[model samples]
Target: MAEYKMTTPLTDEDVEKLKIGDIVYLSGTIYTARDAAHKRLVDLINEGKELPFDLKGSVIYFVGPTPPKPGEPIGSAGPTTSYRMDSYSPILIKHGQKGMIGKGKRSEEVKEACKKYKAVYFGATGGAGALIAKRIKKAEVIAYPELGPEAIRKLEVEDFPVTVVNDCYGGDLYEEGRKKWAKA
Candidate 1:
């Protein structure tokens, strides 16, 4: 795999260079969306209305952060469970979304979508809230602020760490990596 430096509006070349289990320090523009926000976004797409943000080459982070401390952009930002969003991801992927950042096992449909759409899913370390929050340089609510933490926030980050969980070629690190260490 080739080395890639993450930047705003990542390209297929950036994503294609990543392999399962490779760590990345993502920078540039990333959009936050959770369960409630995803539901609304998918609904809008179904209605043929404009989405708050473009999906093409975009990365969606599955996070609901705590209130920021004074002079801070955010607090305790971390990936949430991904299964809850499985129903909605295919639609987003179909529309040109390229990447997703979250934790835990994903549905097969989601994996299929990644393969079909040439998208990737990254797994952020769970319980590393403070560490993760430090990587975020700025944050601002772009939509759905009434939903509080569920609001879609635009975050600019630096060296935001993640491991590639699912790759476009159907590689899954969590399962395969564990099996590699499993006793015969």
Candidate 2:
């Protein structure tokens, strides 16, 4: 419905302003994590241990990138199916995480958490890993290196394209779009 250009470490105000179906180009630091990394992060949280990165106002991208070739900050980097992180997302949102970047549907709990916490869920173009990789300006493994591609990485991205799939106001583009098309 609208377009926005946002930077990472997104504040509550930044996320609250977004609406489902709005296009977004994100530029700033985002952390990468997939299933394994998410589990570890949640485990750490439960143990009251220090996390590798600060969660406050942060955006997490659900991706496990391919190994880079020479002179590239990252390789094919695409969003993974978001549901895999559903079990852990609400907890992260509660900890001050303001945004999530991934693809596909999320659970009810995750959606409620977004609304309750003033966070948003963004959907990256699936199957566009190579194109998305180009937007990443820098990447460094921040934790769980043994997991290889699944390792948590800190990434600096520039104008990385995405769309708002869910917003703080309880909007869900996937559901809304489906209903719209179903009625047509």
Instruction: Name the best candidate (by lDDT).
Output: 2
For residue 42, what is the lDDT in candidate 2? Answer: 96
Error of 2 at 166 (Å): 0.6
Per-residue lDDT for 54-128 in model 2, tens only?
999999999989999999899999999999999999999999899999999999999999989899999999999
C-alpha RMSD by candidate, in order: 1.3, 0.9
Clashing pairs in 2: none
lDDT for 123 in candidate 1 is 94
Give lDDT tens digits, candidate 1, residues 1-184: 3445687577778777888988877888899999999999999999999999989999999999999999999999989998999999989999989999999988999999998888899999888888899999999999999999999999998888888999998899989989999998
Instruction: Give the runs in model 1 whose Cα sits over 4 Å from its true position.
Output: 1-3
Q: In candidate 1, what residue range of length 10 has the lowest lDDT sum?
A: 1-10
For each candidate, how many residue pairs have backbone atoms clashing (under 3 Å)?
A: 0, 0
Quality of model 2 by C-alpha lDDT: 0.94
Q: Go through the candidates in order and give each one's C-alpha lDDT.
A: 0.90, 0.94
